[model samples]
Target chain A: MGESILSGTVFAAGISVGPAILPGIFPLAPLLAFNPFTEPVGVIHYMIVGAVMFTAGVVCMALKRNALGVLMGIELVLNGANINFIAFSSPYLRGDGAPTLGLDGQLIALFVILLAAAEAAVALAITLNFYNNHATVDIDRADDLKG
Target chain B: MTGTIRMDSIFTSVLLHLPAPTAPVVAAVDWHSVLFLLFAGLACGFAIAVVAAENVVRMALYLVFSLAATAGLFFLAGADFLGAMQLMIYVGGTLVLLVFGVMLTAQAPLVSIKPSASDRALAGIAGAALLAVLLAAAVSVDAWRKPGVGEIPSPTATPLGMALVGVRVDDPPAGAPLTGRSGYMLPFEIVSVHLLVVLVGAAYLARAKRRKTPRAIDVLASSDPPSQGAVLAAAVPAVRTTSGAGGKSALLGGGH
Candidate 1:
């Protein structure tokens, strides 16, 4: 049994060593410690990621001429906020005495996801109607309502 | 006593002589962090890709990847039930949106709508500033910087289920009054009703409409034949001016 365990250990080590060495081959070795692989991640890391996605979504909404593209942006923005809620509520991501949100965060995220789906449905229907009327899906031409 | 001491020393020596265990090396990988990195990278990358891509179909596809990655993030954060819900609803929503995009853009002219270069530059600058502010705020929270508990929380599906029905089965908020906290029953009911209304409204809005032009067959079927001819002559000019590429009369060529 001991012999089998030792052999398995050696085999696993051999496999892991190859990948670990390959990452070293990259020029970013000096920044290896800062990599998420080397350290335990926390809520802040998740928050930063959420921020990036939210910003991307905002930019998408602002720049995309296609109505569907704008809808996609809105989805991204909602997901970003959902990430933050989950991260904040996550017990695993909370340190001792951190006053975590417990189930509330997840609850809010759940509602957000549901509402987002509903919003998307209504928005898509509107976009289709707009396309039917105007013969285009570009938001730029949606100025029929403009005063 | 001497014999036991000698046995202990021998056991220690045996452990020391054997190859150091590989447990540390294995544990060092931090699979949680690795998965977090993988999911977060994909989510953010695909979101940006969705924004950058001009083709609506490609943007929808990228949005799928981004939302799927987000679902993975939810799972990592220990919201397994929410994660699954996100996957099911969000992906279904995306699929519906994709169908709409395909249907509307089947007329090849509408496939890609490129925004002006000035618009792109302005949006980029605004996005950057917003990102800077958000990142600064996210990092500035001192309590949030503390390392997490790093333990799998007990599954929360049951408590969440109860909570939705107006029961606060989970732990109450810290330092709150002894009076029991309220649940989400009100909002739940409201959303359910709202969704129903949205469904009906959307169906009404998207239903196929009769073409504006009076078809020749329809005119022949009408009792007032001479007056129909006069009506067609009067309508033709208006239809010609309004219907641009796919003129209304031509669209009715194949009876719906």
Candidate 2:
């Protein structure tokens, strides 16, 4: 458990630097301007960042054999989508008047969060049942479902 | 100290870029952004840590931090109700179930499950590629690069709450009002029911095994004995029981 907490702190520190580091990789990053901050915060930039995070989550989901790992991946994907939704709703990145999903985007993100919780509960229960029967959490052993 | 400019006004005035006379009511402070960054950073970081950690309980701990951060982000984003729901439901309720499951499944020998190095390598490669592609797509969209339509709009909690109840409180500037803006009453109701079913299902799954505990004679006469985690405490000399922080045996379902 200590290892997990350590990793969480490390990963958060990494992600915290994302907004600061991203501009270096994308030269055109400065051209757009939606941010209300003294700096240039653009919708494209936010969306792009969200997409990266989402993509990372998908890969994590696909590769993890542990049920918990898979759940973590789902979280990453949800967070990525959330970043996009918020970026869309933010006035700092978009111009004075543009089409937006508006409150609907935020609402959708909220629903996604709530449902994610429900999904976690159901998944955790199923995982426990699997362990009870098989004495392990290896998803590979669940191949009986293929039959 | 006398020259101290209020932090909120300094930010609002500079960010708004409007002359004092012409500027709309610029809040001395927008507490939202300050709080938003704090939570967003916490949630995203802890989530990543959960992926790297090997210990089940530690992973659960990280999950708790991540969810808490996400809840804070929700509030900062002006979804106060959603944020509160996130705290009460996901962090407090569902996560507790997850922890219980973790406790049940973590047998004496299998608490910290580490992934093989090869698997980690493959996942890292795939994750990197996916991140690259998504980042490229995000940068390609030109419209998203400009200031949004709702930029600097008034705080939205009331309108959002009313909208959830079936109202379109804010009119779009210089455009025909939106159509089919039905509030989220239906989805809200559905979520409540979904939660109820999940609660019942989790309870049933976690119920104590109905099969009777092995009879006392079963250990020496018929059944393998239960591990002495509880009984061993009183049986062993007190001086020998503790192995301190580095002791994995302490975590082997031992009450101590």
Highest-DockQ candidate: 1
For residues B1-256, could you state the per-residue lDDT of candidate 1 as single tens digits? 2344565566666756653343633445567888998999999999999989977888888888888999899898889999889888888665566556666665676778899999999999999999989987876676676666686677888999998999888765443344536699998989999999989988877766445876665544322112212333333223222333233323432222
Tens digits of per-residue lDDT, candidate 2, B115-212, equal 67888888878877877777667665556555333345556677667777766675542332467556887888888999899878876664444434
Regions of model 2 farther than 4 Å from truth: A1-28, A31-37, A44-49, A145-147, B1-41, B147-150, B172-177, B208-256
When candidate 2 is compared with the true two-chain complex, its DockQ is 0.20
True lDDT of residue A53, candidate 1: 94
Best model number under lDDT: 1
Clashes of each: 0, 18
Worst 10 residues of 1 chain B by lDDT: B222-231
Docking level for model 2: incorrect
Return the lDDT, model 1, position B1.
Answer: 26
True contacts kept of 1: 0.66
Q: The CA-based lDDT of model 1 is what? A: 0.74
